[model samples]
Target: MVTYTGDVTPGGAPDVRDAGGLRITKVAVDEKMSNNCYLLRCRTSGAQVLVDAAAEPDTLLPLIGEAGLTTVVTTHQHWDHHRALKAVVDATGAEVAAGFPDADAITEQTGVEVTRPVRQGDVVRVGEVSLEVITIAGHTPGSIALLYDDPEGHPHLFTGDSLFPGGVGNTFGDEAAFIQLIDEVETKVFQRLPDETWFYPGHGGDSTLGAERPHLAEWRARGW
Candidate 1:
């Protein structure tokens, strides 16, 4: 069993986590941007889902291999986050999905149609694995976080540029937006999930809710 470090570097190697039924592959891309892209593959049915084709199809497509991708989920409308989305979808013909509010912008930017304009409570399936949609607005109007509760273990969260290790995502200097992002992150994410829930961010490494819960007040005071 390979260790899941979650410390991926651009052009290095993906960090793989084999958690019973699901295999999580986290790769770094977009060069200077240092964006993170994840592949969630189900062992039983062999269905796969790509989270944020942020960049470098050469790097991403190979990771996908012959099994082919079932879906490509764009986290938000951020240009940096969807750079390779078109290429991946073109090569795999995978269905595209994103937050309903940001779906249009993602399409306009990437020119790839968002077939599934998902919202809160919606579930995305990777074969038999289920990922619940959690809209964590503020970083972007349509920013979303995907939650996967491991039936046998702890919960896993895919927070695309929303929650991070130290603080929440940047709100571009809008305190109200910062408040909204943090509040949603608090209510929908922090308050709801247990301390052990592990989260994967859009960029950088991963962290657990327990590691980050203590700094919520500090993050709020600083107003990111």
Candidate 2:
């Protein structure tokens, strides 16, 4: 079964689980906002990457353990998502990466330089594991998702805040932004990936594309 732990506060622990051969850990650093930080480790070479340095560096650093962090990727430039980015980067000395358009905002907010500017189709390597970048706009112009294909299992996607379980992320009531988000999610994500592909979002519990696929029309009709 998939493992899930409570939000990481002063004394809370993180959720740890194994997906196929990759080791995945999630910590809810910002409980009020339910912001999530994920750590993905390659079982073979022990290389690891942190997806979204949400918040609470003291809580997140310990969970990283001895494997060390190879990279820290900010999925978007949202403040809540990168609150602890500078702290984590300072402690781990890991390379900071983010989408091209959002990189400047992230750097300005976190005070940590984004050394790598990733775009759609770019590949990020962590030991033996390879994560492909998929740019999804609307939620944020440079919002991006990472797709990791486990040769022996289904693919896993780390979608920042662009795609969620119930529907596409909130577009701040912008009709055009909402439409753009849905269109990008449907064409770039649902249509291209298999239904079994699992997604670890920026917050809350995880979800599979299959569980969310049937409701595409519903989400679109509601215009959220």
Question: Which candidate leads the pack in lDDT?
Answer: 1
CA-lDDT, candidates in order:
0.94, 0.87
- lDDT tens digits by residue: candidate 2, 71-116: 9999999999998888888888899889999999988988899999
The stretch of ten residues in a row with the least summed lDDT in candidate 1 is 13-22
Worst 10 residues of 2 by lDDT: 2-11
Estimate the overall C-alpha local distance difference test score of candidate 2.
0.87
Can you write out model 1's per-residue Cα lDDT over 1-224, one digit (the tens) per residue?
66788999998989999776889999999669999999999989989999999999999999999999999999999999999999999999999989999999999998899999999999999999999999989999999999999998999999999999999999999989999999999999999999999999999989999999999999988888
Instruction: Work out how many backbone clashes candidate 1 has.
Output: 0
Which residue segments of model 2 deviate by more than 4 Å? Answer: 1-11
Candidate 2 residue pairs in clash (backbone atoms < 3 Å): none
Model 2 TM-score is 0.94
